[model samples]
Target: MSFRALLWALGLLVAALFAASLLIGPAGLSPSDSLAALIAGRGEAAALVMREIRLPRAILGALVGASLGLSGAALQGYLRNPLAEPGLIGVSSSAALGAVIALQTGLAGAFALALPLMALAGALIAVLILLGLAGPRGGALTLILAGIALSALAGALTSLVLNLSPNPYAAAEIVFWMMGSLTDRSFTHVWLALPLTLIGWALILPLVRGLDALTLGEDAAAALGVRLARLRVTLVVGVAACVGAGVAVAGAIGFVGLIVPHLLRPLVGARPGRLLPASALGGAALLLAADIAVRLIVPERDLKLGVLTAIVGAPLFLHLIYKTRAAQ
Candidate 1:
């Protein structure tokens, strides 16, 4: 399909899935009632369920998914690495570590916003540390190494907190939060994550020309006036903002970034510039579909979004690795 057609198709799919996410739920209301409740706030009970429960969840599913997808595409394009993903920069793990700390110290319990706030703080700190470690002259290899080290350290600290937790309830909370879900979310999360996500999008969307040039190699791109250093800084900070805000509100919804960009790349003719927006739409649709499936697959079980994504993504990731090896 042409690029325009691909975008149109993806946009329609996202719209459909978003509607499904808003309408399908345990409430089992008719589609008409759901729409009415959502639009007009009719039917007090249905309105409450629609407005207070499903609406925010649907909005977040789309927002978080788009962020992850956009971030992944940007990272892959900038790093020129198929395996690159949003989490590669350690922001997600660092954010998770921050949330875990808040829970462990009862800060999350005492203050409703503490968990997400701390998580955002952790992500910001990780970016600063990553920049420091990568340094001004650092290349992709150096950035990768720095990110890996930061991710490892943050993950280890999170494990340590879980291991030493005295309160079972707190530990349980931490564990579930890490697993990731859209359950019981509110507009507070919607508002909290929106501005940063938009800013990240702004930061990333303009790098299309740079990303396209980089496909020809770093030296060639620089010779073409791509300003490699500026591109790197923008990409890193943008991914941090997107991933940080996402993990802050939704925990760690793994694989949306990895899977969406990878799936849509071939369709975009392997062009990084085209892949970015397509991946964003694809990611939003995939996550919304996944969220809806969670509601339908086991209404009582309350399945975690992260677990489902991992189950689907891990095998595919391994297959990608195998394919890469064979090609090499």
Candidate 2:
């Protein structure tokens, strides 16, 4: 298909999924009524559901998914690593660790920005440490190994926090939050995440040209006038905001980043810059659909959104690994 057609299809899919999200809750409202409630603030119950619940959820799903997708594409494109994802690189896990600490230590409850701020700090720390461990000139093998070590360390620390929690309810809450879900989220979360996520996007979007140049290799990209140090800083801070804010509100939703960009890569002719917006829209659509599926799959059970994504993403990831090995 043509590029225009592809954009149109993705736009339509996102629009449809956004509508589905607003309408698919337990409230039993029709699409028309839900849209009406969202747009015109008509009817009490519908208005409450639309304004207070589903609207924020849908908006967040869009923002978070876009952030993940955009970050994943940026990372993969810049590093030239097919498997570079937020979770794989320790960003998500590190952010999760911080948020868990905040929750366990009662810092989150004491301050509204505690979770996101800590999560952001954790992400920044991960990026700094990863860069130090692997260096800016590290190969894919070195990067992956360093990332694995960091992820393990973050995971271990997060578990330690959970294990040491004196309050059983807090421990349970930590576990549930780690599992990840968007259920019953409010506008407070929406507002908390929006500014940071947007800032991240703004920071990363301009690096597309640099990302494209880097495809020719660091030296070649530098010859082309791409500033590697500045680009790296932009990417690190930008990804921290995106992944950190996302983990802050959504609690570790994984693979929207990993899967969305890969799926859209070919459609965008594998161009890094072209892939960003496409991946963002694709991520939003995929996440909204997944969130809807979890809601319907076990309405009473309330399946975690992260569970479904992991189930689908893990095997696909394994397949990619196999394919990469076979090609080698």
Predicted model with the maximum lDDT: 2
**How accurate locally, in lDDT, is each candidate?**
0.82, 0.84
What digit string (tens of lDDT, one per residue) describes model 2 on residues 228-279?
9999999999999988888888887777788998889889888897887888
- TM-scores of all models? 0.88, 0.93
**Candidate 1: C-alpha lDDT:** 0.82
Looking at model 2, residue 124 earns an lDDT score of: 86
Q: Report the C-alpha lDDT of model 1 over 87-135, residue by residue, as the tens digit.
A: 6567678988887887788898899567766776787788677667766
- Stretches of candidate 1 off by over 4 Å are 102-118, 124-152, 162-168
Off by over 4 Å in 2: none
Candidate no. 2 TM-score: 0.93
Best by TM-score: 2
